[model samples]
Target: MSDAAGTDATVEISTDGACLGNPGVGGWGAVLRYRGKEKRISGAETETTNNRMELTAAIEALALLTRPSNVVIWTDSSYVKDGITKWVAGWQRNGWKTAAKKPVKNDDLWQRLLDEEKRHTVQWRWVKGHNGDHYNEIADDLATSAARNLRDAP
Candidate 1:
């Protein structure tokens, strides 16, 4: 990977998640590419929501970075992008309640993502899912494959 302009080093990661059912088997996938090398990571949960898998993809990707660097994270989920960039602080201040005064959903995963994000210089980028973007497509494929594998497992 190329160094991001004005930055000493950079890593670009794309992530996606899939669920066989909203609260059923799910999988998360992430592609972490840097310094001309690429790594793909994925996992499956027997029972999970799509949003939870989405958050897991991001959390796992960031956890792979051992040191701080300028990082660009690409995802198709606006919930992830906006939740981290726009709403997390307010939620934290509100003791994990939404602006509507309801307890935040998936606060555990959100908190994990927040912790991982704080360890790096992160830029969140949103892409349209199922689009032709190469990395995003790969991530999506990996997620779907993982989910399928889980579904097929005895």
Candidate 2:
């Protein structure tokens, strides 16, 4: 899609992540929409954290785009939003260290997310999880199903 200004138009996306245990089996899901078309994608990991899953959702969603476009990404994770939009610059400047000078957790994923983010113009929006938002609920279901699938796998 292209805006009137000749720039790539915005694609709306909703993403969510779920974990069977905080540091155990986890999954991420995303829904993307543009010009009345939609796509859903999801994946799971045998061992991970809720935060990692959350970040993964956004990463996977953005990575699916075939071209650089403006994107509005809806997520329930303040950590993903704040960490990327607010804190990442400082973390990069400090060699990926937190305020306490400790190494940042999930630095690898964060770096990957940042790399994917650079490919597009993304606006991060936060929605309350499980609050009955249609897309959010759908993404949640996808994530939960992925987690369950992984857990049930031999």
Candidate 3:
């Protein structure tokens, strides 16, 4: 959406992930805010890791943008924040291997994140989890609720 200034609105987003077990039912959630308008979205996967879900939340939210945008994403997962901001470039340069020469885990989501990131000017900020930050808490609730529902599904 464009602002009154005729420029693309900056989007503010908060994302989170949850799992019933480390590699069990996993869910991801994202809340996107643009020009005072907000959207909340969440999803689940039967077998996945929390880190993958976190990455998925960010990827899914950013994917909703139809054009390049200025976006800021707040996340509780250091894996998501640091992976994208601190580690991805090196990972790419090393052919998705870590400095220890080990293959990067969740390289698939990392690749997808990198692609989505290219379409926006994004700033990733890490927020401490369970700290009563409104947006983070909402995202966490959404993720946990989704995971719990999926886990309880018959």
Candidate 4:
């Protein structure tokens, strides 16, 4: 865990999600930064969707932050980023239903993300995938590794 950039002691997280098929093996990866150093965390599910993996990556990353701090999160999933930063308030006002009057998907993970979000001041940024960003590439690699592991695991 070496400091790649010279930033203050704040948490910077980058997450990526991968799925073999729409409802097939999937995985998520997150790179957590603190004091210029990084910790990589990832997991996989045998049967899941890309959206779930995306939300799971963010959820897992936020869970790693033990204390409230100025946090920056970079994600490739618009759903995860937009859902929290934009749509969450309206959803809450509407009793967790979408604008189309449909129940929100992944309510559990969304609740966890919202809870963790309340505990910290987070800045969400959407990054384009496969754009040669170092942290984003690392997260993508970790996610693909997790998906491969899931497929090979007994």
Candidate 5:
């Protein structure tokens, strides 16, 4: 992340993902805060998984940075947090395979996330979903609403 943030500007981001079903309409959202300013971004997919949407939220959040930054990301998905912070190196070393010698699901999104992450110092923090966290709640609402809109699209 040294290259991602040439200066010392720090950004706070909260991200969440939602799906109508495990492999159904999905959406992702992120709220980015920097120096008292906030920006919200969200998108939906007609067919996707929750994990993909979660990963998309992170990737999109990082992609929004115009410059390198110290980014602290809050997420509710352990799969996202652990996969990036803990298991990514192993997966990469094994050529994107899991410990059980299985092809890693959502490897494409993982690669995109890694690519976006390289441009910033990213710290992933996991929060419990559906709790009272304000930022997380907003992000969750954004995602769930987007997904629902797409699910109910005419």
Candidate 6:
């Protein structure tokens, strides 16, 4: 069941992250769509990195599924995409350490993401962001909005 944009191959989800500065105010967003209905979710952090936001977006998206189903996740973050699809296994085998023998960054979120991922079959795809993809654009907007909201919060 694919959408007009060929995004419905499975329940299609897209996520984005934004940070005012590398480790400043940050936010993450996710857009989930299935059978014509769409849901958007976003959150902000007082201080965080883009990678953490990216992982948070993916984690939140998967958490929304709530049922066992195949899914395709689209994201602009190679860190999120590659980290889960490529590096996770090795990390698990190596006691969650990186190739450089350093502790993996964002281990908490990464572990949570791994746990949530087990609830569904997920395929990670990289999308070229800011190129006007509908879901991707929506996600980016939500992330920016969240970041702005965080910055403006009293």
Q: What is the lDDT of residue 2 in candidate 5?
A: 24
lDDT of 6 by residue, 74-135 (tens): 99999999999889899999998989999999999999999998877788999999998999
Candidate-wise lDDT, in order: 0.91, 0.91, 0.90, 0.87, 0.91, 0.88
Model 2 lDDT on a 0 to 1 scale: 0.91
In the range 1-154, model 2's lDDT, one tens digit per residue, is: 3331236557899999999999999999999988788899999999999999999999998888878878999999999989999999999999999989999999999999999989888899999999999999999999999999999998
- Writing each residue's lDDT as its tens digit, candidate 5 over 42-137 gives 999999999999999999999998877899999999999999999999999999999999999999999999999998778889999999999999
Across residues 60-84, which tens digit of lDDT does each residue of candidate 1 receive?
9988877776899999999999999
Query: How many steric overlaps are in each model, in order?
Result: 1, 0, 0, 0, 3, 0
TM-score of candidate 4 relative to the true fold: 0.91
Question: Which residue segments of model 6 deviate by more than 4 Å?
Answer: 1-9
Candidate 2 — worst ten consecutive residues by lDDT sum?
1-10
lDDT, candidate 3, 20-139, per-residue tens: 899999999999899889899999999999999999999999898777888899999999999998999999999999999999999999999989989888899999999999999999
Clashing pairs in 6: none
lDDT of 3 at 50: 91
